[model samples]
Target: MSLYQLVYYSRNAIAGDASVFEAEVDAILAASRRNNEAAGITGALLFNAGVFAQVLEGPLAAVEATFERIQQDERHGDVSLLALEPIAQRSFSNWAMGFVGHSAENAQRFAAIGLTRGFDPARLGGHKMHAILRDLTLEEEAAAA
Candidate 1:
């Protein structure tokens, strides 16, 4: 199968109080992990400053199908596809659906990386967004280890 990677961002539309939001995010991650693993897809999702950025890598058909489901989900709004192209390898190969959420330390790290104003995925573009998610997820993996 030809490997392909897709990068996208969406405005958070999960309406609720903090607890509700957290629960919804947890549910999303759980479902994504299960479905992605079954479909042989790997990816990382980053949620920060009311935005969701994700990178998905796998067979072209699987990635596209997964993305189609995401686009139809109500939790996401204004879902914009940033990049979708053939890739030689998977960047998040170890993860079915790695996730990184907002935190004080993460805010500081974003600022240090020249996102002091805020995390704007559209302006940052696909490559930078992918890099940020990849780096942050790796950091999380290291901490878990």
Candidate 2:
């Protein structure tokens, strides 16, 4: 299967209590996992506050199809793609669907990789987390297995 990486950004507007938002987030993630697995695709989902940064890799057709399905997800709207590139490596060869919840520590780890200026708790939106996710696919590929 040809490997592909896709990136997207969208504004977060889930205005309510944290628990309400969390429940919605859980449902969205579950649907994503189901869809990807059915298509033989695997990757990771990184959610930081309201920013959704994901890297899905698998058969070219499946990658495209999965994104198509993602666009219709009610929890997310205004999706904007930042990048989509072909790579010569397989990052999550063994992961059917890996996930990460972004936090201060993860932000710091991303900064060390040169993807951003470093973890600034106040500037979470400014950090290039998607770049970090793309790099992690390879950086932690061994561990991912």
Candidate 3:
């Protein structure tokens, strides 16, 4: 089976209550992990400043199906597909669905790692968006190790 990867970003539509957003985020990530694992998919999720950037990799059909499901998801507003291409191998093979929340420290860390100021994907272009997320994930792995 050919391996494929999909990258995208979206805005959080979970508004009104802080508790509600938090609960929704938790449920979302949990369900993502479960679903991805069952489908043999791997990916990482980064949420910063109410924006989300993610990369999903796996079988062509599985990744495409997940992308379709995400498009219909109400929790994710204004979803933008960044990239979808065949890949020889997985960059996030270790994660079923790793998630990271936004923070000043993280923004600073990412900026220091070469992402442009603000780290907004819509402003970064697709190629640059993929680069930033890829580097950030590597940096985080280094830090964790």
Candidate 4:
């Protein structure tokens, strides 16, 4: 079966403070893991600064359907669809919905991904956005390993 990848970024609905934001993120990851596991979706979700960037890869229909629901989700606004097309394989296959939390030192830690300029999904192009997401996801995997 052909695979599809959907990448997007949006402003966080609970961005004013850290405590609420962390709680919201935990809830999102838990729900996403449950849902994505059932749907056979493999992807990564990144929470950095005040934005959410995610990459969902799976069957064409499944990926598209999931993206539609994400678009309709109220917690996400100013959504920018970075990349949405076929892919040869899943970059996040080991995860139902892997997550990466950002901190003050994250920028320096992830500077190899060209994040030294800061992660601005709005200004970054599709290729660069995908690169960042891939790096973040792999970084998480490496950390776990």
State each candidate's clash count.
0, 0, 0, 0
In terms of lDDT, the best-performing candidate is 1
Residue pairs with backbone atoms closer than 3 Å in model 1 (clashes): none
- Tell me which of candidates 2 and 3 scores higher on lDDT: 3
What is residue 117's positional error in candidate 2, in angstroms?
13
The sequence of per-residue lDDT tens digits that candidate 2 reaches over residues 50-117 is 66666677778888888888777666667776667786775665556666655576777655653353
Rank ordering of all candidates by lDDT, starting from the highest: 1, 3, 4, 2
Q: For residues 52-137, what per-residue lDDT tens digits would candidate 1 score against the true structure?
A: 88999999999999999999999889999899989988889899999888788888886777655455678888888889889989
- TM of each candidate vs. truth: 0.94, 0.69, 0.85, 0.87
Q: Model 3 reaches what TM-score against the true structure? A: 0.85
Q: In model 3, state the lDDT of residue 20.
A: 89
Where does candidate 4 stray beyond 4 Å? 110-119
lDDT of each: 0.89, 0.64, 0.81, 0.80
Sorted on TM-score, highest at the top, how do the candidates line up?
1, 4, 3, 2
Clashes of 4: 0
Minimum summed lDDT over a 10-residue window in model 4 is located at 109-118
Model 4, 5-58: lDDT tens digits are 888888877655778777877888888888899898998887766678888999
lDDT of 1 at 135: 93
Candidate number with the higher lDDT (1 or 2): 1
What alpha-carbon RMSD in Å does predicted model 2 have with respect to the real structure?
5.0
